[model samples]
Target: MVASGDVGVAFAMVCGAGAASSLGASCVFAVKVASPRVLAIALGFAAGVMIYVVFAEILSQNAIDSFQDAGYSGNAAYRLATACFFGGMLATAALEALAPAEVVAVLQSDPHTRDLLRMSIVTGLAIALHNVPEGLATFVGALEDSEVGASIAVAIAIHNIPEGICVAMPIYYATGSKWKAFFWGSLTGLAEPLGGLLGYLVLSKEEPLSFGIVFSLVAGMMVFVSFKELLPSAFRFDAIDRVVSTSVIVGMAVMAASLLLFTL
Candidate 1:
């Protein structure tokens, strides 16, 4: 499973496997209906994974590396990391504003047999930008601390699950083919590990700088995904205002707690 070129395939398999697991689990027992409470919990879990990656992996690592600097305190490095993380979040927010409205329009206008071919291309570009640094994070973690790396990898995999579902749901709803929808959804996520591999091959020649750049980009990518995809999707779930607010708050709180506990 950890072999080379398996990065994207691994992500797809992991996410698809989760979907498969759910189906299999349903067979053994009664299907666990995802009520508003359950949806909120799943969102919270995703948030926890995100927050852990941003602080624990990004900030803590930066603080340690900066220890050797003459005037720089670990505290300063930590602060800097926080600033960058938030800054990355802001950058993502900005990009979300630029998300092609045409895509959304098309998705809603005619879900079945909708002309999403162009929108899919745009999605691929956006995902590619997001995947590059994620891949590096996975690779670097695996190399430096296999145990920690494995944890991060698994967390990332968990994070990608909803993402896979998000991609597939629309297409599936439109086209009515679970397999095709799943295929595209899973394929889009492969960019991360693929980017990871490419980043490693290119950046490994220069260690610290490579790590820093990779970390920074990962931060950027997360912010983009959060604002551009996750938050929007959360709101799109039309049920009740209370449900939406509760879900969003839970997501934020979950991320905050995960950062404080795992990273701080």
Candidate 2:
């Protein structure tokens, strides 16, 4: 059973994830400007980081952990992991389908203020949904290993920067209120802590959680967010192909190196 202290640590780490989003939002106010091309490249980079982590670390680790901890044969462990991964993807797909649509009509609205307000709210809600699994991942990692959790948090924080910009820029432009932008942007990340709390409560029973299943599910969620949300949104910015590609490559390389460094 996870000790009370460990639970506290896990919650703290999850809170840090929320703070990362706030930090990212703060950057928008600091710069007082937003560039679609820059945001696009950042989003591409975030996608690459998440994709690499999901495939290289999370999925592989899930299989290995299952084989070792659950006494499943290698094939069986892999199969189970794959199933859990797909299950997570299906869940995220459902969430995406149900994401708020009322604000979408604002895209075509003639009034710039109305358009920006609606767009900001929509972006915040979307990011909030994406952050749920991420929060769970961070909390779970921390519960298992503090170092691993910290690394994951750093990677997730990097990705959240662009998300913060997405929320902040439009709102600031629309309302010309830094406080409003910051509040909304920070609000988007609050879901992380809530997710973390829920995960802890569900997984902290006397029966230990299944690492394989949970990890695989988390990997799937990250993959869905990377491809379905981050990459597509990045491309929508009309960023130059080379910039996006280069950013993605650089992001993968950096995450790979970080993981390697942490292991050593």
Candidate 3:
């Protein structure tokens, strides 16, 4: 039941939602200090928010819903979704293992900036990849019904605001440049508009299970990045477990609250 007209308006709607990441990234300027403790909390917060969304939103809700929309039913849909989840994890593991050490070192030559830069880049990439499906969904929703699409787009923009924080804060702490942080954070969101274009023209109509698969894959990639990159970087930057742990909880609370807004 996808209509083909209004491409311009739908594109704009998705772009507006995507830009919220930049809006969130801009918030880093308000923080007063650039310190190891701040970076730790940011990293922990990023991990917590991502981990919560992976379980509570992506895998639990979006993936299943997409599959059911594709005519999958009951436990069969759950089983397929779980399999795709593990497949995503294994794929990320393979890619991480295959990445050359020399390339990694070359990317960030400064010892101080090395791990933090790499981790943030990985986090941004994962988030960006996930946004593709989201963009598609937004475009399709808009094409189906403008009012509902606008409502969903606003909700998505609010949720993305925190994800922007997740991408920018660590980079700001690492490089001490608000511009650099915002640039990278904004880059991650560009995927949304691009995804909207691709989905509207290519995927949304013909491919029903694509969103479900992409959701599971990205959720896996996010969980992997949280444990492998975010948490470890947090511990390395600051030894205070109490602060990191508390920030992690706060991040989860923020993400949960944002997601709950979707239901209302």
Candidate 4:
């Protein structure tokens, strides 16, 4: 269990990690104005990051490792992980059902603008959902071992920068308001600390099985958002001919490098 004093330190680290998302959001100021192509590319880039991280880190590594920690191995772990992934997708679908297609009002007359806002919303929600379990894990880790927890938090913070951009860029481009985009991105980042608080109250580092399932579910959410929301909207953009595929690739590469660097 986490010590009382360590609780404060763990919470602080988790908050710092979450805040990195807002740091990523702040990057939006770099582009004061955006065009159709830029928006499409930004959406594609976000999707790419989520998809790559889901497959490479969340599912392939974290989920399986979690199952292994629970004493399951090989095919058993994979099967359960797959099941959890779909379950997460169903959860996202349920959340989607709560909102109509035109949930957010778009003042822009451009047809693609509606989809852009939708994509941003989907991305933000997915990122926020994913961050929760991560925060919990980090908090628990810090409770058990400060160095391990700190390392995880720092890696997550770096990972979150792109996630913040994933939420911020499309919103910035779609809404033409930096503050709105930053607000949404910052909002998603807050979920990390929320998770940390949840850990402090209830969860601990032990439930490998549960944590594994959660990791898979989060991966599923990313996959669902990427294919179901982000990519479709990106293709629908009028200036889609250029940048979509390239941006996606670049995002994937960056995510891969980020993961690799952490491993090394």
State each model's C-alpha RMSD to the native: 6.6, 3.3, 7.0, 6.8
TM-score of model number 4: 0.60
TM-score of 3: 0.57
Predicted candidate 1 versus true structure: per-residue lDDT over 57-130, tens digit per residue: 55466424633232446676556555655665665556545555543334354454546655654653454455
The ten-residue window of minimal lDDT in model 1 covers: 21-30
Residue 91, candidate 2: alpha-carbon lDDT: 86
Best prediction by lDDT: 2
Candidates in order, TM-scores: namely 0.59, 0.82, 0.57, 0.60
| Full-model lDDT, candidate 4 | 0.71
Against the reference, the lDDT scores of all candidates come to: 0.50, 0.73, 0.69, 0.71
Note the clash tally of each candidate. 3, 0, 0, 0
Candidate structures ordered by TM-score, highest first: 2, 4, 1, 3
lDDT of candidate 4 at residue 60, scale 0 to 100: 85
- Cα error, residue 59 of model 2, in Å, equals 1.3
